[model samples]
Target: MNAPWKSGSSGGRDQFAAYLCDDAAMDVLRPIVADLGWQPEKCCRGGLRNAVQSLSVTASPNILLVDLSESGDPLSDINALAEVCEPGTIVIAIGQVNDVRLYRDLVASGIHDYLLKPLSPVQVRDALTHAQAVYSAPRSHDAAGAKPHVSTAVIGTRGGVGTSTLATSLAWLFSADYKLPTALLDLDIHFGTGALCLDLEPGRGLTDAIENPSRIDGLFIERAMIRANDNLAILSAEAPISTPLMTDGSAFLQLAEEFRQAFEMTVIDMPRNMLINFPQLAAEVNVAVIVTEMTLASARDAIRMLSWFRAHAPQTRVLVVANKVQSALAEISKGDFEASIEAGIHLSIPYDLKASSLAAKLGQTFVDANRATKAGAAIRDLARLIAETGEAQADSTAKPSLLGKIDFKAMMPRTRKKAQAGG
Candidate 1:
């Protein structure tokens, strides 16, 4: 079965672009391109590299056809091409391998479609025809002058930092308190506790949606979501211990887009194991929240994660939440932690062991169980800040006036051997 394109309707392919194999593949594709009414200048030889080099010097067409038969690492090659490719460019890859994994990976990485090689005119025509249709489809936009959907991804610098707890509270505030349609996606398939935290049961909708994206639609999503209340719903799964759960990068992109269309705000509980795909996922969202604590080890890892986001998803606004904060007994003070990272801590949730443990046992959220507590009040404020405005103002007192004055490498603790040798 042919995979469906997200938009557009069938029409002429005069504006399409292609980079095909130099030998028989080009000969086979030439007549097909002409029959479809695409321009000859849009077609070129030299495969993925040629397409990248050409796009660097000129504008990218609406559609891009890359021949990956000769590529030893097609995934990496496609990623390089994507950096130079235009925003709306629909990429269709042609390769000799018929592997299901390869097809899934390419689709997951944002390619429009994939056609197995040893070329055929019929396949080429059909794929391009579908691409043209999707390109022509009208895009869905929010009502005129309405705020666009906001998506926030909450990722932990290290495990056991209460990332899921914070994500859940944020979703609850958006739906229950602020009265906006909210979706909390637990991307952690195996050990996810998003459902349990809300006192709801895990469903199979997320798993099915990832495995077969074509089946995803409004009805499918509605059925998959477990309703917590009138405004809030959750999409999560509970995988069996023996069953191996794997994530498809493209499927996640599709899922995130779908969530944005259906809700005003979406909070994602990102799993640490999916770090490989985090950059792609991070790029799709408007806000990224990194959950860490007041510790040297957490600080080191947080710096690395912050640096990665700076490089991969620079456009995304980042916030650091210092969870379980305790300055009295802690080795590093909050001010020192913020100074080391070169970014102010956006929110600080005080460490309250008694309240946290009680809430966990009762399967109730911290804010719900202890609304009067310090931690509960802090979480509520965080939600209001995100809901009303997309960002929180950094504490001017804590945040350094100039980032250039702070040397991050010098802040980290050095081993005794290195310190002694330097001396």
Candidate 2:
């Protein structure tokens, strides 16, 4: 069982395979499998236990369908199956149970989808089609030299707090200075300045994906995103304000998934309203940058957002950044604002109206436009900290290679003996 939203198929894997407990279900799944142009023999006769045994010996398929009907405890059997299943294989389970709690539990356990027994051809076909879509969704790795994707979402506690500026600057620093492949996702669908700040024409790619969520894939990503430089690309939109938002937020999520697959770093310029309406969008983010000033309103909203994240997305690391700080002419003192939010302001960017205006006038990111300013120096420091965080995450999750584990010096004696013997 893998994350429903995340899956992949490695090399030498069949496009589709199934293990059915009975003939009736197999009959339903067979024709649909064939409709997808797959071989009928791939749909085998068995159940979850058989799947575990078979996959243990052979490579797992890209899309694995297993029957849980014969199992006494589905969850336990699924765990057993997981032990043998390869990483990133998309798994679908067919079972007789129709309980909603069971479905939620199975989803939490990482099953891609669960189908109740007595399935119809149409239902099977639909499920299989959706599974294929998930399979075809962009993946982060294809075997060698796979990289860890770090996602950061930047939000403003209040309007006119320079959230976009910080987002753009951080993205620029990551791409131009730290040299990480980066993607800047502007969630402000109608009024985004992301492309404008970088002197780019806002494209219709985001709007197209919003109109048709199913069309999102690797190819779609490659075609839709506008490259900003050798290492940076951005997907932004300028939809007409008259049009209403019709999506259930799935398009944005699908975009986030695609970003994870396509770029090493994803900086999402998420509006506060989006955070309120679409909380799930923040689920996979590695960090959240909350930009605010030392004002009572900002402090109150920061407090609320900090609590919201603790309750909703506790896994994400929160970084509170106070922007446009002027110690002499501040609404609230830095210490008082920190006390109000009950968390320290991680970084405070000093007020530099001239620097900010110059960046906007030049159509450049603040860090790129005002490197000599103290505000620029602070942003660069923030970027360094963020980069270090990424490096630490990479180090923590890195898997030791075979070569790394080999003791070459210790093996030299054996090598010398072999050389002397001329074997």
Candidate 3:
């Protein structure tokens, strides 16, 4: 039982390694792995036996792909290898037979997934991509039995409700004030303003990552983000208006899982048009903040969104933020709004046109412009509440770090700068 398997002779090690018994399968898998940016040390034709022997001597990688087509008894071969495989290792079996019973048995015996033979490049790539997701899942629990990362989704009931503003502020506060590594992802590819709001240029890699999710990794993510500071990074794409934005639900979910693994906090500014994948995205996050105005139309839309969340993703904590609250305007009362929506108002941001416009003109966040203002204070409180809810225990008096500070004047556009100077 204590016998060690011989390690592979290959000098380099990789997070994902594969062992194939068939020459045809190896030919198909090698280039796919290379294209995915994985440098697997062992890609030889020893099959499951070779993999078992190799893993016995060396530590198992996060993901292990083994071919069981040649094994007489695939189940028995896998059981023997299970003794040496690491506890959290995700095993993906590629075999010649397409038996559902065998596949079910392998999964029951702790295998992550199974793939049939004659694997094309796309088939092998998708299987490995899914395996990466499983390996990246937060398996380690904290003292409170919570995952290490915090995922927050900011959804607007309708457009022009300052949802992006709130999401950006929360992300900035998490990185600057709370000193947490945060990722701000704006799902609105064409009309997204998260980068512009933060005075950072939109990156083209985001569109590439979304379109080709199989290529997403640490290096890809680092290249995709527009680094605002040491702890804060923004991921958004500014495609042309005519550019067709098409995406599947699985891509968004996979991307979100990767973000969760990469950052301490992940804040998403969801697009209003992405209703098809909104529920799936909301299910993955720890909290969902729905932004709405005080008008009846906004309240009606908020109720519909709330009902959908309750029916689909009940486990996710939901918070309703009433934005642009103006006492002069004829709007619904706070109590009536809560009663209609069946959720309390977690935050109520007073309408301050002057302060909001000034912050936008300067390309600075409201909290950065003046943290003591009503809107700024409310946003800070929202960030603190989200942190506390996620069990992140942030100090009440925390301030922005030097690296996190944004020079709004320098970041301002030349036209805006000239206009401001003339004024």
Which of the two, 1 or 2, has more TM-score?
A: 2
Give lDDT per model, in order: 0.71, 0.77, 0.72
Candidate 3 is scored at a TM of: 0.66
**Clash pairs (backbone) in predicted model 1:** 7-134, 8-133, 8-134, 8-136, 8-137, 9-133, 10-133, 108-250
Ranking by TM-score: 2, 1, 3
TM-score of model number 1:
0.68
Worst 10 residues of 2 by lDDT: 410-419
Q: Please list the Cα RMSD from the true structure of every candidate, rounded to 1 decimal place.
A: 12.1, 12.3, 12.6
Candidate 3's error at 349, in angstroms? 0.3
For candidate 2, lDDT tens digit of each residue in 26-126? 88888888889998999998898898788776777877899999899887887777766655567778888655445434654666666777887865776
lDDT of 3: 0.72
Ten contiguous residues with the weakest lDDT in model 3: 407-416
lDDT by residue for model 3 (155-196), tens: 999899999999999999999999999999998888999999
Residue lDDT tens for model 1, 163-237: 999998888888888888999999988789999899989889888876765556567878889998898999998
Reference-based lDDT, residue 31, model 2: 82
lDDT of 2: 0.77
